[model samples]
Target: MNDQVELVAQAIYEAEHGVCLWEGEPARHKERFREYARNAIELLDEDIGVLLLALQEANAGARLRRSKGSVRRDPN
Candidate 1:
């Protein structure tokens, strides 16, 4: 869809499969995963906000078109 949406989706995919450099240490790996998880959550939240705003704008435009009689309805 939108460029920003695509970027966010890619970021999410990367985050889910991210690898830690300290691969041999269990504690370090867990810590790195936790950090990545937090960042992913924030990014997801921001993306959701953007999508919601887009939805609202689209709805408003549709409503305006309907009020102006530019959008037509089916007789069936």
Candidate 2:
């Protein structure tokens, strides 16, 4: 839910909407879709990287907390 990730999500939604809801011949908008696809690729690699790192850190923290809590039960 970071800003960067949100932007990426918006871009993806717009791309899907534009492609699916075009009113005219699809061939006329090939370049536009191509640009959208390219931008999506960059966003996936750049913006999502932050989210991925955040998730990794969160998972690590959760695991640490679980281990600490479970240790208290080991001797019982």
Candidate 3:
């Protein structure tokens, strides 16, 4: 797959096989895992922010349409 997906998969594999790779330089591995976790969290936060903005825009549009329709139908 793409580079980002590959990197995430490799990190997950390493995490799952921690027991096998823990013999040497466990501290270094732990630090790398922390980096991976931080990157993943940052990506997730960005995606959530985009989704929230889109939802808000959609809600505002729906409200505007309903208000306009009601104003047109008013007898006064």
Candidate 4:
């Protein structure tokens, strides 16, 4: 519904329809899609909390590994 989402949606539509609105190489359009997708994800992160959940899981795994002494030591 916001500007970033709108841009991503339009890029997706163009990709599906094989249409390019920009006056550049075809690869630029693909890059635009990537940029738009990244921007959309960043914007959504504020409301989604996915990053926080991932970090929490990572931290828990690290703690469990530390508690179990599962860390590997380098052999010299």
Worst 10 residues of 3 by lDDT: 1-10
lDDT of 1 by residue, 31-69 (tens): 554565456546667566665465457546756877889
Model 1 segments beyond 4 Å from truth? 1-44, 70-76
Candidate 2's displacement at residue 9, Å, is 14
lDDT of 2 by residue, 1-76 (tens): 3444433443444456754233343664544554654565576775657655665575467669878977855556
- Rank by TM-score, highest first: 2, 3, 1, 4
TM-score of each predicted structure versus truth: 0.33, 0.37, 0.36, 0.31
> What is the C-alpha lDDT profile of model 4 across 1-76, one tens digit per residue?
3544434545554557675454354666656665766675677777535644554475467569777787677888
Evaluate model 2: give its lDDT.
0.53
lDDT of 4 at 25: 43
- Residue-pair clashes per prediction, in order, are 0, 0, 0, 0
The Cα error of candidate 4 at residue 16, in Å, is: 38
Off by over 4 Å in 4: 1-48, 70-76
Off by over 4 Å in 3: 1-44, 73-76
lDDT of each: 0.52, 0.53, 0.54, 0.57
Alpha-carbon shift of residue 68 in model 1 (angstroms): 0.4
lDDT of model 3 at position 1? 19
6: Cα error in model 2, Å: 19
lDDT of 2 at 49: 70
| Candidate maximizing TM-score | 2
